[model samples]
Target: MNIDKITRTNPENMPAPVGQYTHITRIPRNAELFVTSGQIGADHNGLFPESLNEQVTNTFNNIKTVLESERLDAEHIIKVNVWATEKIDWDFLYAEWGQLFSTDYPAMTIGYITALGLPEIKIEIELWAAKV
Candidate 1:
């Protein structure tokens, strides 16, 4: 599924993003937008893992479930925000992300914070999606 009307821009005047993200994402006025609450790194039963990699995987998995519940796919996603309590394994995280977004990268920002909602929660992800 693809929303061709959505626009993703990376201004040439600006430096390229260090990772897989655009500088801006423009959604059409006719599209329906969806905003999700930050999803934490926990399993289906709400169990958090100890390792950062496991937490990252769980976070993305949770986001996938949210999208599925909404009957939406990665093509509808336009923005993503990530928060982490510890240093991330970029390669592992990106691989997990690739399973969802593929080449349809979105505008994104990631922050390394001191903590999340729970002491065991190591990562969180928020998403904004639009369907035309």
Candidate 2:
């Protein structure tokens, strides 16, 4: 979807998304789009954080690095998919989410999985963004 033409909505008539996502994202024609593969909480040297909070922090930081490399930021994000192996801390996650997106939250989906690429990895995040 084209970033410039993207429209995020949560119809008042419908139930809000269970988490931090919007219910709908409309993308206009001819918009440039970028999709990132799921990012894990691994640093440049492949080190992973043990705590869920630290892992989540690293994952988002990595996402920021990727977006910046493409001349984009959180404002350009339309959707996000998150996966985690451990029980989620909703309050902690939402707090971080608030820090990242502010009020411009995007459509998102989160899942709990049994495992990730590596045993120590606790979280993964992928995103879609656009620029007109």
Candidate 3:
């Protein structure tokens, strides 16, 4: 299996996702899988931004850096899981999602929690990708 063989779908009977993501993703067996640890809005120096929007942005940037380190891009991503300590800015998140994925959305879930790893960390993201 390869990146081109990955399947993304939204069944007609099911309600659409509230954000920029597909309802399901199917990755073929035998594909190489890459999974990342949950990433927070911190830089290499362990500094985090105060704003939720900036935190979310930094979180995604960190995810990107991890993926690139493994020679993978957004297109190889099959699933994403996000955790946030505050209410999400759907518009801002969707805009950033578009920048990274365009129309090739992946299976995703976002959850609001009371707290994260640290008090200053507003958002965290983890993802799975595949390649042949």
- Candidate number achieving the greatest TM-score relative to the actual structure: 1
Model 2 lDDT per residue over 35-114, tens place: 99998888878799789888887887888889999998877898999999999788988887777787767898888999
Model 1 residue pairs with clashes = none
**Judged by lDDT relative to the true structure, which candidate is superior, 1 or 3?**
1
- Please write out the lDDT profile of model 1 over residues 70-114, one tens digit for every residue: 999988899999998889999999999899987769999999999
**Which is the better candidate, 2 or 3, if ranked by TM-score?**
3
Q: What overall lDDT goes with each candidate model?
A: 0.90, 0.85, 0.88
Give lDDT tens digits, candidate 3, residues 71-119: 9988889999999999989899887787789798999988999998789
**After superposing candidate 1, which stretches have Cα over 4 Å from the reference?**
1-4
Score candidate 3 by TM-score against the native: 0.92
Each candidate: RMSD: 2.8, 2.3, 2.1
Q: How many backbone overlaps does candidate 1 show?
A: 0
TM-score of each: 0.94, 0.91, 0.92
Model 2 clash pairs are 2-31, 3-130
